[model samples]
Target: MKIPSIVFALLFTSFSYSQNISGKAYYESKTTVDMDNFGRRDMTEDMKKQIKERMKSFLEKTYILTFNGNESIYSEDEKLEAGDNGRGFGMMMSSFSAGDQYKNLETNQLIEEREFFGKQFLVKDTITNLRWEVGKESKQIGQYLVIKATAYKQVDPNDVSMMRRRRDRDNEEKNEAEKKEDTTKVEDPFEDLEIPKEVLVTAWFTPQIPVKNGPGEYAGLPGLILELNVDRTTILCSKIIINPKEAEAIQPPSKGEEVSREEYNKIVKEKTDEMRENFRNGGGRRGGGGRRFGG
Candidate 1:
């Protein structure tokens, strides 16, 4: 039996595209920081070095993205915490960290679990749509040939973790009476921190892989994103596995109290504000051991 060439080509194409495609991408995420930004000019050089070293565990982390066609799950790869791990820092910083995140490209839905302080909240929101400017530049990330893309993302104002502390200024013009009055008024410790309205995001994606997904909240690229650079942090794919024997089930987190993203942010801000007020009123120990970041 002679098969027509076009028919054979069609069959081959169908076979190539028909199979259920699933994979896992491992990413190494790291954030670069300026030591001076810690706002600890009083610390000696050795003290600053020690602080940086301790911060390595928090600044550098591993994450796994499990995806199958239209759905994906991104979560930190679990590892035992070191005995000397910065417990206070972890508790404080983690309040700002996102837990397991699930994305449904088909429906444009985003579900994320977050543990703010000790309370759990499930943030449900629509997936962010990034207007990516695809570039002609291409590079090799591992075996994948990735092309460049850039976009600007609006920074959430309430996201204290992403905000940086503004440099303090001495008000030489203020009279002693004014200074005394200021001291009497309750002040927000995070008042100096600020997040820009928008920040540029750079991404590297490979068309060879046909999934429109990536770590964190980024997606909608023509192919899978292998590397992402945003806000002084770079998330690079260390490894990729296509069609592994055991496919992780993509499931949205459902345990925490469901709240919209805005609501969740408001909750965090309120709690943080209360903490700040307690600290200013000398009720810090009464509020519990002062676990604070951005000092």
Candidate 2:
């Protein structure tokens, strides 16, 4: 006996919905270190060149976001690979709404719309504005409907460098000029930098969750972004857990760097340089001082 067409369709739909959506989100942020008057004053042309070369040699980093609503909990696993320090991995769990807020977990403070690579990203922001051009593509992510959309934005390298240098100089001046230091004051490093005006970035997002949120600085989509790629890295939503059986509360991460995205990048760069220098001076074991994967 042949099955009815409607029954077959229903079965196919049910099977599709039963499959959980899971994927990895990859991001490649390109940054240029300029030695011009706007950038690092102490950096020589050769040093800048070396820095650029080092950055170019970096491998892509991976972050995993699992969403299963049925479980009533949420968790995230981030694996950072490459660099001289080897491999490092971190696991974080929180209430489903944990990533939705800017909270401090461990030493890492969550921030929102922090600028990195000359563009603004919505990390843990209550409000965000992300604009993208509509495209003609549709794909299925689990049981939910998905549409592919693209957006283009320019990134300014000059702004990043200048902002970094200004922050550095300001910090130094403050440290030396103040007779009485007020360590309680919180400083925003990107205050002096203007919005970026060069270098175009394109991104793809899917609107299924009906929320304008995504990993990093991506937002403003009509739905949840399942897959995103720009600057040569790709981020795809592999699995989503909605309303899980037992409801594991998704807690925010406890250990990760917390700063404006730009500040974070600067810190990473400085740390990398320090490690490299230590290795060169034989003060650290070879390949041991730098960032290691799965740390």
Candidate 3:
């Protein structure tokens, strides 16, 4: 006598959920940059190459997500190298990096730690329920069969990390003329920066995991998300351990002053505005190196 397909599925689901399962997922994240489109137009290819090499740490990263059925903790696997103080340009890019994040599916909550300009902030926000358009397309990621889902997520306007330089020479000339006309008025440094209001996010999840969790603030999937394509970044799950012999507890970060996500973004905008203004006014001048900016 053969078991009914629906009955077998039900039994399998029940058995999978009944166990106290916990595991870790290791992810490799890579973000691509069009070197030609960034920085100054006069920048040589060798200069761009050097800058890209310096930015490798920020562009390529690894993270580990420790998760169970209801909650998960996602954090970077920090690797300390000699002289890797994350200084200079790396320091500027570090503002875009996210710290440890904790998500609770049952409560629909997201708590994350973010460091901006040397200040640590704990951001608390509700988990956004993405309107995923699940497709029939499927692929194999490792041993699990994963299905594709796509959604358009609203981009945070004050997210400086998402900002890109608008390559408009006319606008630059106009700004320069205006600056010359009115030396007293400080120009808005963000005038040339552009960030899209929304970005398409493509995700792949495996129903076999039976967990609604993923890296960063992405959640609400039917299963564990194995890969994500958001903006210019591609995050892929490199390895997964289900029910390891020892599992670390998923703990929410408690350090730093607590603030809502909106509040934090506001603070970041204000601080960035001040910093940009200062830099424009020669606040970043270095001795022996002369002024970093030209009049």
Q: Point out the worst 10-residue segment of candidate 1 by lDDT.
A: 1-10
Give the per-residue lDDT digits (tens) of candidate 1, residues 1-295. Answer: 2223433343455444424778999999998767675533356878778867776776889999999889999999964253464333434464565689999999999999987766677999999999988776778888877888899999888876676555453532353345467766543445445677788999988766777799998998767899999987999999999988998888898968889989988877877777776656763434455543231
Candidate 3 per-residue lDDT, tens place, 122-229, comes to 899999988887776778999988878899999889877777656555665566677779877544445556778988999988877878789888987677899999
CA error at residue 176 for candidate 1, angstroms: 15
lDDT tens per residue, model 2, 147-219: 6656555553422231222324556445434424754433322323343443233444443343444555455
TM-score of each model, in listed order? 0.81, 0.41, 0.82
Looking at model 1, the pairs that clash are none
Displacement of residue 29 (Cα, Å) in model 2 is: 13
Lowest lDDT 10-residue stretch of candidate 2: 88-97
User: What overall lDDT, based on C-alpha atoms, would model 1 receive against the true structure?
Assistant: 0.75
Worst window of 10 by summed lDDT in candidate 3: 286-295
What lDDT score goes with residue 229 in model 2?
Answer: 62
- TM-score between model 3 and native: 0.82
Q: Which candidate model has the greater TM-score, 1 or 3?
A: 3
What's the TM for model 1?
0.81
Question: Could you say which candidate leads in TM-score?
Answer: 3
